[model samples]
Target chain A: MDYISRYLAWLGDGIRDWLLNADDTGHKFALMLVAIILFVVVMGAVLLAVDRPKRVPRWLVTVGFVGPALLMLTFGLVYPGLRTLWASLFDRRGQNFIGLDNYILAFTQSEFQIVLRNTALWVIVVPIAATLIGLVYAVLVDRTRFERVAKTLVFLPMAISMVGASIIWKFVYDYRAVLRNSEGDLIAQQIGLINQLLVWAGLEPQQFLLNTPFNTFFLIAVMVWIQAGFAMTVLSAAIKAIPDDIVEAATLDGLSGAKMFRYITIPSVRPALVVVVTTIAMGTLKVFDIVRTMTGGNFQTSVVANEFYRQSFVQQNAGLGAALAVILFVLVIPLVIYNIRQLRISEEIR
Target chain B: MTTTPPPVPALVTGGVGDDDAGTQSSRRGLGLDQRAAKAKKRLTSPWASLLAAVIAILWTIPTFGLLITSIRPQSDINRTGWWTFFTNPTVTGANYQEAMFGSQTNLAVYFVNSIVITLPSVVIPITLALLAAYAFAWIEFKGRNVLFVAVFALQVVPIQVTLIPLLTQYVTWGLAGSFWTVWLSHSIFALPLAIFLLHNFMKDIPPSLIEAARVDGAGHVKIFFQVLLPLLVPAIASFAIFQFLWVWNDLLVALTFAGGTRNVAPLTVRVAELSGTRGADWHLLSAGAFISMIVPVVVFLALQRYFVRGLLAGSVKG
Candidate 1:
């Protein structure tokens, strides 16, 4: 027993050192190779054990297949999820139990109230705006010669990271304070496209990301930009899926253009439209990157997701962060449930 | 939540079983193809085409601006809008050169780290989920439905709820601030969704196929490896691409576990940090942003058919 324990310790240390202590690119990639080999060996062993000629118990076979995933989920997700929930009940340091205090503060405090408001604003605005744009674009481009290229143009953003997308928009929203010559003539050229457009219209250039409440809208626009592609893809497929007979019937009834779209196209894609809006809402609810990259949640632009990160990692307020995380989790539940329910109904109809 | 409920869009529409969805793509397009011809006869709405053109431009110009700016010289980028690049063409590789190899922002190192982190993260989760998914789909045991449902429900647990505690545990295990931590955490987070999706795919396999293998006295492991895996290649590819893009483009998990260290921090974290600290340096920011985007964009464009299939499966019922 003593030898076994000692050998296990030695093996663990050696593996850890090999995987973690290596710093160079060669060593890191070597580490990846080692991981793959190790995974293959372990899974091979498990399969061999289950494949013995002697009859194996059903439960043992199940365990051999399922144990590893369940073990990982237990340690990594389930146990920690419960712990975070428990920690949210305590104070900032997560020591003293101050039940619901963090939750109360999150709801009542002026700062967090703004966070909630910004989140609500994002959830409502991004999905509707992106979906409307995507749906309209899908209808227009349906079966067109340039449909592929046109769809790709809008859908490209979904391929880029939120961080990258944020950088792009941040450049678009880039502000250089207006400068004047001695004669009071405008001297500074607007670097940002948005402000440049405003200048072209003979309007004062506004700081799109610095203004309160409205700044949140600018951040939300970034999300809508990224997600509109997803909406377009899903809705485009749905539009195409509208039954031929139904469209033929609508066409026979003299329904054309807006009337065809309003009656046939809209009704046919309603299920998909619901799924797209709710999925985008769920995604929008958890969007921290745009806010983090654009404003760093400054100027009252924080959402629940960003605030969770700021509290837990930045401020080291585990309790408050956990509370915020819980709030995010709670917020996502209804959306998921609704999404699944809609999918089931859609599936049944199919 | 209901018992044995389907998982969220990340799974249902995760594009995992998209091969099944791709075959139906032609059928879905049938209605619209016919509608286009009839609609042309009624009234040609030039306004619709114009609106779509405007929307396409709106969607594209931001990225286009960044792309143009990334190549311009530092002075040009700072002094003027990227739109002016056409008239005053002064392109330089210096920004790309510096953003990649320069000190204080050696994105070259982070780019390697993203690759190293993403490969194992995608591979490990898919392998484990394949086995687990096979078990859920084929193996009959007590509590099987319950266990499968539990895994499905786990998808709804926001990753934020698990980060801090998992980090503490990683620290306790002496794995904190390592690629192992990022890889392990990503794999773990990816498991529930992976299992749910693969299981859905496996369940769709004809039961007679499995029964035939069973009648031949082949074991479960053999059947999984020999019979199902071949059929599941498309499914695996779909999820692999999805997870690959996800882990590569991810910022939060990498940021939390790897921090700002060069050894383990991926491109997203480093690029995000650059945006914060060097927000004014469009030369570096634009270059850095593209450095991160190039791989995913290429992958997406190449495999867009499969991606759309997976997406359609998730949203529109297969």
Candidate 2:
């Protein structure tokens, strides 16, 4: 027994070291290969064991497959969630029980107030802007020659990480407060696209990411840029699925262009529109990456999600972070409920 | 919340009266003058075409600029706009080489870490969720609907809410700051949605098949493996791609669990840190951004139908 425990711990340490401490990438990858193989074998063994016993009880077989997922969700999600909620009630170190102080601070404090404001701005602006752009594009390119290629251009960003998009847009917004030459001609060029366009228009290149309040909108543009593709793709399908008969009838009603779009097409895709708006809203609410990568949540561009990370991980302020996280969860509930309600309503209409 | 936005302009470029069914590439480059005067009439509304073209160009330009910048010489990159490539074109693989293996930023390691972290994160959640999904769909458990809804509701728990407590738990187990922590964290974050999506797919399968198996003395495991698993393949592929893209692109969970440590941190963390710490290095940023984007973009383009199906599944019933 003593040897078994000792051997187990040593094996654990060695595996951990190989996986987490190896200097060479080849070693780490090789170790991952071995570990993944072991994992598959163990899973295969469990299933094989259940398979061999042909007359196993219904409930036992049910539990055999479902139990692992249930246990993981319980330990990984449910317990930690409740713990975080509980921790939100405590003070900075999480030792003292300070009722509502963290929540109050998150709301009333000047800095966190900015976070709430930024988050609100994000939720409001990103969805509407992206959905509008996406819907417009989806409608125009519904069955055009270049429809797939056009839609892919926009939807491509949804697959890319927010980090990548931020870098992409950060370059677009990159501003250098460059000095001028003898004829006031620029000696230093603005490499960023937006700034260069401004420069081309003979307007002074503004620091797009540094100016407060406006910077939030600049950051929001990145999200809109990415999410619009999602809006277009989903909404396009819904438009296509609108039965051909409905379109034929609508066309016979003298609805050809803008009038048809205004009256028929919009109403037809309402469910999809709701889905797009709410999904984008929920996604926007939880967006930390754009803020993190673009500005590090500086210049008052921090939203609740980014603020939560800043408070918890960077500042080590557990209580505030927990409170911020709770606030995020709270904020998301309405969107989810709203989304579910929309889903239900759409189902009824169908 | 329920109100739809105004319908986009109904400028159908191809009119209702027209069927370009026989239209092929032969018509593509033919000018209205060269082909026929009536070719111009094929456009129902030129204004709509113009608007769509403008938006598409606007959308593509940012990435286009970055791609140009990525391949440009470092000195030229800093000196001129990427659009200037049209006039004085310069291309080099130096930025990619430097970003990948340079002492300052060996992004290649983090790219490998991204792959490592993403695969297990994707595989575990889908596997576990399939089991849970099967149970929810088929089993006559006591509180099945309520439990399923509860699991679905868990999706609303912003991952930030779980990070601190989960991190503390990991530290207690001496697993903090490791790939295990990332794998576990992503798997956890992914389960609620994965389960919900798969269950929706599973419930759509006819109960008669399962009933027939049950009548033949087959148990849950046998029914699942022999009958349901085959039908669930497309649904599973749809979700596998969804989870694959989600895990690959995740930043918050990765950052929280992996914490910028070279051995575990994904490309996102490294790229983000570079933007924060060395904001001036557009050369490295462009290459790194492209490196991170290339896989997901290719996956997206190739398997787009499945990806779109998953998106619609979340909204419109498939």
Q: Which number leads on TM-score?
A: 1
Compose the digit string of candidate 2's lDDT tens values, residues A30-94: 75676577667866766666664456665676676778788888888899999999999998899
lDDT of 1 by residue, A126-218 (tens): 999999999998888776666778888888888889999999999999888988899976798889999999988998889999987689989
For model 2, the stretches where C-alpha displacement exceeds 4 angstroms are A1-12, A52-55, B1-42, B311-318
**Candidate 1 Cα misplacement greater than 4 A, ranges:** A1-16, B1-36, B39-43, B310-318
For every model in order, what is the number of clashing pairs?
2, 0
- Among these predictions, the greatest lDDT belongs to 1
lDDT of each: 0.86, 0.80
TM-score of 2: 0.91
- Give DockQ for candidates 1 onward, in order: 0.54, 0.40
What is the model-wide C-alpha lDDT for candidate 1? 0.86
